[model samples]
Target: MIFESSETSGFPVATPRAVPPSGRRPGWNKVPEVTVYFWTIKILCTTVGDTAADLLKEKAGLGLTGVSVLMSTVLAVVLAAQFRSTQYRAGVYWPTVALVSVVGTLAGDNLIDATGVTVETASSVFVIALAIVFVVWYRRERTLSIHSIDTTSRESFYWLAVLFAFALGTAAGDLVSQRLHLGYWLSAVLFGLAIAAVGLAHFQLDLDAVWSFWTVYILTRPLGASIGDYLSRPSGDGGLELGTVVTSALFLMVIVGLVVYLAATRVDVTDPEHTSRHVA
Candidate 1:
C-alpha cells in the first residue's frame, strides 16, 4: 500500500465536498466522475508523476529538457484525443492526466534546476498564472465547476487550470518540503493535514464546494509528490530508499488496477444532466 495513514494521498474529494448537495451538475464529459475511485487513481497518478519524472530524467538518461520535450509531446497527442472525444473515456482521460502530471512536475523542475529560479519565485509565478487562468476562465465561462466542462473552451480552460495547479503544487511542495528542510515524510504529513482541514471546512463549515474541490485538487499534487519522495528517495536522505522505478511501477500498477475497475463499473461516470453551480 502507499501509506499507513487514514487517507493515502490527496486529490479532489467526491463531488463538491458537500454533505448533501442539492443540485448536482448537469452532464458529463471528458473527465471521470468525482468519487472515491476517482481520487484513488488521481492520487496514484500524482505519485507516479513524481517518481516517473525522476526515472525518465535520472534513470532513463533523458536529461530534464529531453524528458520535458518527450512527455510534452505525448501529453499534446493525448490531449488532442481527449479534446476530440465528446464523452469521458477512462482509457483516454486517465492517461492524459498521468502525462500531464509528469509534464507539470517537469515544468516546475526545469524552472528551478535548469534556470536559476528559486522555488519561491517559481511558486509565486505559478500562483499568479493560476489566478490569471481562473480569472479568464470565470470571465469567459461564468462558472468554474469541473462538472460544466462539456464545451471545448471550458475544457481548455479546465486543462490549463489543472496544469497550473500541478506546476504550482510542484514548486510549493518542493519549497516547503525540500528548501525548507522539512524532509519528505514530514512534508507529506503537513500537506495531508492542510488537505484534511480543507475537507473539514467544506463538509462542516459550508465552504463553497467548487472552491473546496479546486483547493483540494491543487493541494493533492504536492501531498502526493511528498509521499513519492518519502518513498523513493535514498535512506540516507531520510526516505525508504524504494527507488524511483520501483515506486513508479508500484503506483502505476495500483492506478491501472483502479482505473480498469472504474472503467468496467462506470462507478465514476457523472449524470447526463443535473443542476450545479460553481464560483458565481
Candidate 2:
C-alpha cells in the first residue's frame, strides 16, 4: 500500500489503487477518503452507537432483545441500500455506519448479559473472528487497505470487519471500565493514549500503514464508547450526568450537520486517480 503522512492525524494515509480481476471494469470507490472528516464522523458514530443503544433500551423500554431486533432490522435495510448504491453517498453511508454501531453494541451486550459470557472470553472470541475475516479478505484480495473497497466482495469484507471491530471494542471497553474498575473517563484516556501510541509507532517507528490504520480504527471504538459513558453516566458513577438521551441527541445533531455538509460538498469522495496510480 502507498501512503503519505496525514496533516491532521500524523499517521500514514493510504493512496493505493485498486486492481479488479481481469475482465472487470473498476467502479467508483464506495467509501470516503481517509480525510479528517472520515475519522470525525466515525468517532461520532461510535459514540452514538454506545449511548443510543442504552437510551432505546431504557427510555423506550424495548429491553435488550427488543432493541437488538429493531436495530438489527434497521441496519440490514440500511446496509441493503448501501450495497445497492453505485458509489458513496454521505447520507446512506453514515447512517449505515451509525446503525452498524448500534447493532454491534447490542450484540456485545447480549453476549455478556443474556448468554452469561465473560467479557474476556467475548473479547477473545471477537478478536479471533476479526482475525479470520482479515485473513480471508487478504487471501482473496491480496490487500487489507480500505482504499480498495470498490467491488461488492471487498465491501462485504469491509463491513464484516467493521462489525467485529465494534463488537470487540465494546467488550474491551466494558472489560476495562467495569471489570478492571478504571471508570469511564480513565478508560477513555487509556484508549486515546493507545491510539496515539499507534500513530507514533506508524510515523516514527515504521509500522505498516494497513496495520496502523486498523489498530487505530479498533481503538477508536472503545475511546468513543468511554467518552459516551463519561458524558452520560451520573456523577456518582464518575460521569457528568448529561444522560444518554441528551448525549445521543447532541452527538447525532452534530453528525447530521456534518453529513449534510459532506453531501453538499462531496469533499470526502475517494479520488479515482489514486486507484489508477496503484494499478499503474
Candidate 3:
C-alpha cells in the first residue's frame, strides 16, 4: 500500500501501487482491505439490514421498541467480541457490521416514530454527528484510513463512524424515497450514479482516496436500502413484492457465501508491514 498526504487538506491520498506480499500475515489488521469483495458484501449487508428490521418488527410482532432492544443487545455482544479479538476475523468483523446496520436502521426508525421527527431533520442531524466523529477521529489519530486502525482507540473511532454512517444513510434514504416521494427505484439510481461519479473522481481526476472510500461507503447504505425497498415492498407500492423475509434471506445467503469464500482464501487481508509503512 502507498499513500501521500495532500498539504492543502492534510488527508492521505492513496496511490495505485502496492508491494508484493512477501511477508504478510492474515488477520493482522482490524479491518478488511478495501476490495470488490468488501464493497459487494457491504451492500448486501445493508440491504439485509433494511429488510430484516422490517421483518422482525412487522412479521415477528416485535414492534419497534422490542426489535430495537433485541438488536442493540445482540450488537453490543458482537461488538464486545470484536474488540476482544486482537485481529480481524471475517466471522467476527462481518457479523459486527451486519448487526451495526440493523441497529442503526432501528435507531433511526425509533427516533422518528418516538419523536415524530422529520426525515430531513434526522438526516441533517446524523450528518452533523458523523462529521463531528470524523473531526475528532482525525484530530486524535492524524489519519482516518482504515489501514491505520491498529490500536484500540482507532478501532473505537472506526466503529463510531460506521454506526453514524449507517444511521445517516437510513435517514437520507427515507428522506428521498419516502418523505420526498421520489420512489425507491429512482433513489437507487441516484445514489448509484453518485457512487459512480465519486469513483471517476478518485481514479481519473485525482480525488483523495480516503475521501473517495468514505464517500462510497456512505452512499452504499442508501443505495442498498433503496434496493431492498424496491424488491421487498408490495407491488401496490411499486415494488416486486418479494416481501422482507424473502429479500433478507436472499441477500443474507449471498453475504454468507462471499464471507465464507473470503475467509477460506484470505484475499482481503491487509499486509501490516506495508500498511504501517505507507498509511501515515
Candidate 4:
C-alpha cells in the first residue's frame, strides 16, 4: 500500500514514533499476523507460488488463463476460511497467504501475457489503486496502524491492500527484469537492497512503522519472485536449472514447517486493549 502524509487527512494523529503496547498478544495483530518467521516463510511461499504456477501452465498444459482461474478459486476458498476465523490461527493464515500469493502473481502474469499490458503500466495502475485504498482506510479510521486491525472493515482493507501489493510487486519486478533487462539476480539484489534501506530508515531514521512495513512488504514480493525465477529458470534464461517442481516442493515444505511451528508457539496473537498503544 502507498504511504501518504497524515496531515492531508485532517485527522488528530499521534506522534509517529510512539511505542507499541507491551501486552500485545502473540498473534492476531493487523500488522501482517506473522512473525519474522512469517516473513521468512512468506518469501519462501511466494517463490513457490511463482514457480508452481509456471509449472502448472507450462508442464501441466493448463494455459495462463486456466491456471489463473484455478488458483484464484483456490485462493478464494482459503481467504474465506481466513476471514471466518475470529482470531489469529497460523494454520489458516499462512496457507491463505501462500494461496493468495500464487493467485496475485498469476493475476499480474495474466495481465502481461494475456492482455499485453506493459509491466510499467500495470505497476502504475496497482500503485495508484493501493494508494487510494490506503487513503480511504486512513480517512475512515483516523489511523493506518496495523496494530488496530480488530474490526471487520479494517481486516478487509488489510487483505485487499496485501492482494494489491503482491500484484504490484509482480509487475514491478517483471518490469525491472524484462523491460529494463536487469537480469534476475541483479533485480533480486536491488530489491533486497531496497528492503534493507527501508529497514534502516525505519530503525535509524525513525520512519513511520506503517509506511515502513508496507514498503518492505511490497519489496519482498519481487525479491522472492527473483529468487524463484533464478532457481527455476534454465541457465540459457539466466537462471539455475533446478526446475519449478523442485523449487515449489522445497519452499512449500519450509512454509508448512514454519506455519506449524507458529501454530504451536502462538507467535502472532494480538490483544485488543493494547491495540491503542500502537496507534501513531
RMSD of each: 6.6, 2.1, 5.2, 5.9
Best by TM-score: 2
The candidate with the higher lDDT, 1 or 2, is 2
Model 3 Cα RMSD, Å?
5.2
Residue 208, candidate 1: how far off, in angstroms? 1.5
Model 2 accuracy (lDDT, Cα): 0.86
**What are the TM-scores, per candidate, against the unseen true structure?**
0.88, 0.93, 0.89, 0.86
Overall local distance difference test of candidate 1: 0.80
lDDT of 4 by residue, 65-155 (tens): 7788888888889888887776777888888788878887988888788889888888998899889989998776555666556567777
**Candidate 1 vs candidate 2, TM-score winner:** 2
Q: Which stretches of candidate 2 lie over 4 Å from their true place?
A: 1-19, 23-27
Q: Which ten residues in a row have the lowest lDDT in candidate 3?
A: 6-15
Q: What is the Cα-based TM-score of model 4? A: 0.86
Ranking by lDDT: 2, 3, 1, 4
lDDT by residue (tens digit), candidate 3, 1-280:
3455322222233522343233333236688877778888899999999999999999767788988999999999999999998888898899999999999899889878778999988998899999999999877766677775667787899999999999999988888787667788988999999999998887688788888878888899999999999999998998999999999999999989988998898777766665556633
Q: Which structure is stronger by lDDT: 2 or 3?
A: 2
- Relative to the true structure, how large is the alpha-carbon lDDT of every model? 0.80, 0.86, 0.82, 0.75
lDDT, candidate 1, 1-280, per-residue tens:
0111111123343333222223323464567667777777777899999999999988667799988999999999999999988778888899989999999999999999999898889999999999999999877766676766667887899999999999998998988875678888888888889989988996688666667888888888999998898899999998999999999999998888887887898767755643133211
